[model samples]
Target: MRHLFTIALVSLLLAPPAQAQNDVRFQVLGGDEALRDALIAASRLQAVTDEEDSASQDIVAAARSDYARLLAVLYEQGYFGPDISITLNGREVAGMSPFDRITQVRSAAITVEPGRAFRLGRAVIAPLAPGTDLPEGFRSGAPAGTVILRETTEAGIMGWRTQGHATADVGNQQITARHNEAELDAEITLAPGPVYRFGTLIPRGEERMRTRRVLRIAGLPTGEVYDPDEVDRAADRLRDTGVFTSVGFTEIPNPDGTLDVQAELVEAPLRRVGFGAEIQSQDGLTVSGYWLHRNLFGGAERLRFDAEISDIGAQNSGIDGFVSGLFSRPADLTPDTTLELGFRIEHLDEPTFVEDTASINIGLEHQFSDELTATAGVFARYSDVSDNFSERSVWMVGLPLGLTWDSRDNAFDAASGWYADATLTPFTAFEDGGGVRATADLRAYYGFGEEDSTRLAGRLQLGTVDGGDIAALPPDWLFYSGGSGTVRGQDHQSLGAMQNGVQTGGRSFAGASFEIRQDLFGNFGAVAFYDVGYVSEGAYGEGASDWHSGAGLGLRYDTPIGPIRLDIATPVSGDGTGEDVHLYLGIGQNF
Candidate 1:
């Protein structure tokens, strides 16, 4: 009887015989649909390429793997529980097989309910224990109920830790939902502790290169109160030296709560070489190359050599070719003096004349203080010209002496600052046709902004040349304008006095330009500007009437090299025959 019972049980267990046992299939449901949705979501997230069939196939494969994991979880959660009943489209499927059951078990639709986003309610900071050297007022004015509160708390705690308060921490802050979904109220509390003072500063590697000069530029001071902003500023100063490949600062907390600041600096390559080229629509194709030895002869001296060749195009006046040589020495050589010397050669091809010229200039610049610098220079040029109409060869010499004062915080970028510069040149005739000439130039810039990036900039320039009378002036003594740098919306060198198709006269020019710079997206910026100027022969008389004005819009790309500029300008007042719209592409701010 027992044997007979066992045989019957085994037959029943084999189960092709019972309907309930046949329903136990493990179906691979949710795999296909979940995989499809996941793939679509990933493609949207990463902007996957759909044009490639192979890429789509790969995504599908990946999605399949992901969905397999989800299906495994469902299986583990008893989707095939003891009371399992597999159905498709409301019809029962008869099976106990794993594959058929899984195929019939589809994923249930998911629904999400909207939840309120919490707003910041309050923030509280606590001071470190007594004998600590942390600065006070370190955690003040932090807005309550702000998403940034958490980040600010973390930053504050980190700041305290850097000041030798290793045990410093931020207390819990809470956010409460407001009646208005979008509005938030902020609460803040301060917990600045004792002032942390620096203990020591250590220097290493190439001591000659890490001398006082380097230390001064490094911007770290021993015995000063500890502040994160100070530490960051020091790091920035060191990096700005351009002599360090890596820089790091570490603070060690002592038993007595004092802080020891240690800085580690890695020397950059002492020597470097670079080459570059550019093609300008107006200046034509140009090639430039340069080599630099940052630490020439050691002791952090910089030596550089550069060369450039510009091919003048049809849009340019007379000048067809140019070459220049320059040398510079740092101000540390003479306490506050920086010296530079340069030589240039230019080829001029006018409609009626061809000329070759060479010039040499020497300049001495001295920084009276951090906010004031003075420059004085002397330049001499010799030119040989063949008159097109006169059919005569003419030789002339020119000498210019000038002084400049620059106090602007940023030479290339000034949003809320003021700078003024003036130059004077007195000329003497050295040849038969030579006559006395004098020229004066002045410029000023003013900025108005609470910060450096957002501000209004105003600029003014005035230039005048006099040689007793207009006709007595040398051709080279006259002022010329018309380009993005001068009066836009016109041709290059197409302004000033003209006589018989040549600028044989001298004139005075006065102009003012205003620009408002606003930050746009990321590193990009936008600028709107208006420039007004006039060129006249008479110094201040009614006859000095030729004046023109232009307005323009510009886009600035803050590139690593400089700010790349694209400007479109229209002549507000002009002859109207010139190009109505002028476009410019170049590096650096226009000022």
Candidate 2:
């Protein structure tokens, strides 16, 4: 009971402020959900908005300030005609005793009478640009509010500007309220100047990265009709490159009825190095590091090298080491395309296999839009492997195609977003036999409440190998489960197709995970999660297969980089069982 009470208290405190500890009891009487919530949110009823001492005079002063603030809030909610009263200890604040004499404090009451919400009687905006789509509520008999009026005005002006009018303004405005009829009438007009064409790209104040590279990256549609959105997109492109500390675009009128765009850039550091690590109770430890040269080849080219070592524990000496180097040149093809070349080497020692491999891959990735990207590559690899029973050597080449769609607000810690990716690789064996493999993954996040204090996240993954013989396929082409990204409570890569009691890779795989996250305190959070994984020797679940499930709890400490995560879990059901629980420590959300 005590623990339950403590948890309850903490939860209440974490919620966006109604907390007064039974002191200064606050209430709003007689109002709809929207009106009551808005009034409380913008008034002293909220802990953040309460800025006065507990004394009666200070409290009364704060209460008085709420009158205007909440009035404006209601006006935006279409409650143009309102009667609001504030009282302290059941006595009207207007009739309270002098602050010098009144010392006692008790309860506060806010009552709102939003009599007969107002609606638009007539909404007239003249000279609207073609293709203007304003707020849906900007019409006769619709809800009348300040927000609608402001949005309608901005939309009209933006619509004109989008049609090549570089200069657009609100030329006139008239607003009136009919108190007897509970109605409002709004009249506005927009003034749009003549259209203008885009002139040449003018580079300004760019160093280190070169002006031509900046122009190529910006990809502004020069010699086309002037559009503000194009300038914004150009700025976005420059910022996304990470080579610039700051980026901006400015417009200037030319004598030839054209608008010239000037690109401004501030250079960023060219070199950066970073390191991170993760530890798991059952899986041992993993450490990784990377170094990047942002503009090594001068045309926004990037050269990167990274390495990692995993599994440093007593029960096993089969540690794993991996290293890779990659070089990418942006805008080498089209404006939204990048060319990449990479090489990698892996050294592995596991219960089932001890192997080493070296590989190289070359790819071209194109950005179709902000949310979509596609890439195709060719890869070659050679490997030597020795299992507990025998040894084998093989080499292969393959063509890989991949597509991704990302709408997440934050890649590492998302609150309301979705991401999906798919990859297909087809290889022809030089020594053994080859096949085609395909995999796909999807993840989504959703949040609730005003502050998004509660979040739900989910993920699904699937994999298959269609052509290669089971023994001839590259070990890396197969799939396994029971890791941080799969069934967390189980040992890493512990669940797979079994051969003579040895866990080997599988040709088909599926995994699902779900989590519910709750905020506990500032920058602190907790989660309840469930994960399940399935792997089989058959491509379509035809051969031997197994299923595993795990449930867990996690703690998160938010940071600028991402979230520091600590998870503890146990297997609910699985094919392999060796440990009662597993603990994982890492950075970033598990997807």
Candidate 3:
């Protein structure tokens, strides 16, 4: 019974006080508006007093703590000497006992006297590594801001670490304030441990994945000078494979002066499935889905199968579809290289042509960096095509090479940076002889305004089939310049080159699109865009061509995954420019 009584008493003292109203006032007598705001933001009493449930005890506790907190804030702002006081209900809060129980906070007042700001009389950091760039304010005669001292010390330590001093740290700090002269002197010393080399990478928490594969993918340069960046990159590589939900690295120093890094990983589920759909009023609806296996053989190999069906309920084009499968193995030849094998079968039914095609490709992709990659492949294709001009069976073999640079902030709806993809394929067709197909798609985005509320995006697309007979090439290999992808507000495949009074896919194509987007209320945004496309009878815009353009307005509703897009467009220029409007709906930005 006595123990129970003691427990109850302790619980009462520790329990939160009952709800009460508070009126808090904070003033800075010798500071500017910025300093005053900072001090207020740093005050715990000011924060709690704004809450309706703040009790007298809570207010008193917060007020007492505010003394040190406010002083620290002032020092960070170059004020070394400060006086702070807080009063609650006409009583000094600091004088209140911890067990004092009060019913209501009622009112509290805070005052701060910030003395003269201090400038750096002597600022020195010893043994900085070569090429270290410290903060500009960490110099004599500059404001002796406390943050500057921290920045200087951190820079000094980081500089040593970058030079393979894995254990670099701040050894000591000496600070002095001469109150009479309003000056401060700060000295920092760094400890640069012995330079070390990288040992081996140890995998941890990995299930089902091969440990050897993990080490291969990480590509930690064992026996080389230790680099923090390399460790980070190794972790990134594992994450990019999509086999890991989380990846982190820990460093352990060995007696022989080498650092053994451990990769801590959490494996993601092996299988994933996704579906998407898009629609154009004239071209019809398209739906696609994919099934993926992230670790096909416990070696971070990825296998994916995709299928798409299109032209549903279309007014013009016939139904079209494709099925494809891809297999990729990471760390194939080198740590940054990946081997890819793909197979695709496609059927196209357009007003101008109907074709059936099958293709197989083997390729390698090398990552130069996070934003750049290069690919080379060999492919074989078989096609049976029928058009107004001819019906033919064609076989082709090609070497395809590609380079991609992607720095876009977002792939689905980019707000800044640029994306460029260029592909060149040299093929030998049984009917059309040898030829080369080249295409480049470049896009750029710029964002301004607060929180990037306004953005401007642009895209340029160029394609050409050179050194081939236009009539004998696979129909799908040719270019058509009408549809939601080219110029909206026009019928699918409406614009093509004319040969012997028959409209056919062009040998060359060019398209440009520009948009100005503005974020509206909530998750909604508005866009105005213009698109222009040109199709030519010969390669590289060398022959006769026609240009068509469209202008449109769009609306976007943002979601967790991506933005849903709705666009209304009409032909603005060209032979068929008219008031006919077209509508498009999709899950992502048009580009």
Candidate 4:
């Protein structure tokens, strides 16, 4: 009884304090105008939306205090004055009025003073030693504009380092103003301090894999000058070995102005399996799979197997089956010679059309140097086709020879430079009807800017397939265009010489395209392109005189897999059929 009485007395004492806290509530008056003024002063608000049912009334009290603090801030910032008033039940709230009111406002603008343009007043080059050849274009008396400054200053210094002067530097000497408002004068100086030569060639981590063949392919010499391009090439050559996960080169500069380049390597998994699926606007759906073994026989040999199935988007859909085998050796079978064997089988069906082909090829590849590779292969093919227009089978054999010169520093992310490859197939076929099929393809790219993000890539392809009558030719041997790879405004395999909406076979076809890619907004990019192509019955004949040209704009999204491309093209010249637009969704650049 005594404890219970004590408890009752304590509860009685705390009851009043709790009740007073619960009754603590204020009504906020003035509508949107007051809220706006409060927001302008405080920039943020802390209001309780669920306070109506909250058991803890402390939150509501805190919210009211925050509101009152905002009002106080407004008064201190002079946003409120006598014109703005706060009253409760016809009584003004003390200390709730602004100190001052806003009046007139003003803005700031930029103004440029008239002056002469900047010009190159003089140029001088200081070589590390006498008799060092300074390349042309790095001279004084040249213009001092941004363009000239870049070519003579930045590019010049880089060029000197590429040649052997690894410690080269450039500085502006003097500045003078001319009378013209757009003209100024300046002097440029260059210091090619010292020429650095390559040190010992050391292969780290994967010495056994970096055989003589790989070193030869890298094209890096111990006595040669230290060049960034050469280092990059060596890295690429090592990667091509297919034996390493990652390969890179680092240059360590010496106090004597010499640089020691180190080639670092990491071993990679020799065997891999990959699978992917794609959906296309034109091709509809495709599923692909591949299996690769880099060291098939443990001597840096490679073997790959690939399979793909596609459903073309059209009234007439087709299924294609392909099986291929490729075998190669790293070393020259006979000094300076390499050997390759290839075989393929294909089957296709579209509506009432069906075709089957089998081919076998053998080739010899010879590498004269790191930049040049030549291959000559002989192949025999048997093709059979059955369609509404014709049903025929033919066997043909030919020898194709090709040469490739790749000097580009990067294959996947090239910022500058170019590469070229040319192939020619010339021979007679012993089939139903025989003729020559020849093709040539060329591509180039050039990068601008310090980061090499701005680039221009161009391509040209010319081919001729002449044999038998048009009706007697195999369906697979015919040439077709009009797609993301050709003209974007046209349909896949639908562009060629046509007669009354029907394909009239042509003996030759030629195409050329150029694209300029500019990086914008981080990983996003924009592209402008032009394409032209024509098909002819004979070489340079009037029958093929009608050529079509197209121009378009594209947006690119750089993704981890590659570049996602979206293109919209319009036919610029041809039969006036209004305007045609095509949207392409694919990976990598169009080129």
lDDT of 2 by residue, 1-591 (tens): 999989977854553422232344445455578677777678764442354344444555776777898889888978877887877667777665553233444667777777777899989997988788989999999988899999999999999999998878899899988999989999998889878888877877766777789889888888899899888877877787788888877888787879888877778899999999999987788999999998886678899999999887713337899999999988868778889999999998765577899999999999888899999999999888776435778788999999999999889888889999999998888756677889999999998976889999999999998886566565667788887888888777777786445567888999999999989999999999999999998886668898999888999999999999999999889744545788999999886
RMSD of each: 13.0, 9.4, 3.4, 15.1
TM-score of 2: 0.84
User: Best by TM-score, which number?
Assistant: 3
| Residue 96, candidate 2: C-alpha displacement in angstroms | 19
User: Model 3 TM-score?
Assistant: 0.89
Winning model by lDDT? 3
- TM-scores of the candidates are 0.53, 0.84, 0.89, 0.58
lDDT (Cα, tens digit) per residue for candidate 1, span 1-591: 999989977754553321111121233333245433443343221221232222322322332343334333333221221122323224333332323212122211221111232333333444433433333322333222322554555666766656644445545444333535422333433354455666655555544374665555544556666666666666665564456788788867566545665778788887677665444455454566777766554445556666665545545554466667666554444545656788878775643346677778877776554455666666777766554334333334445544455566666765445566666555544444433333333344454444455657777777765443333333445555566667766655556655445544336667678788877778888889887766776553224346677788889988777787777777777755445676666677778
Model 4, span 177-281: residue lDDT tens: 454432334455677766787765556666446455555545566676677676766676567657788877777777765577666777778788987654545
lDDT of each: 0.53, 0.82, 0.90, 0.60
Clashes of each: 24, 0, 0, 10
Worst lDDT 10-window in candidate 4:
104-113
lDDT of 3 by residue, 1-591 (tens): 999989978876777764644557777889799999888888888788778776656677778889889889999999998877788777777787776666666567888889899999989999989999999988889988889998889889889988999999988889999999999999888899999899989999999899999999999999999888898889988998999999989999898999999888999999999999998888889999999999999999999999999999888879999999999999999889999999999999998999999999999999999999999999999999999878999999999999999999989888999999999999999866888999999999999998899999999999999887667888888888878888887778888898556789888999999999999999999999999999998888877789899999999999988999999999999755786888999998898
| TM-score of candidate 1 relative to the true fold | 0.53
**TM-score of structure candidate 4:** 0.58
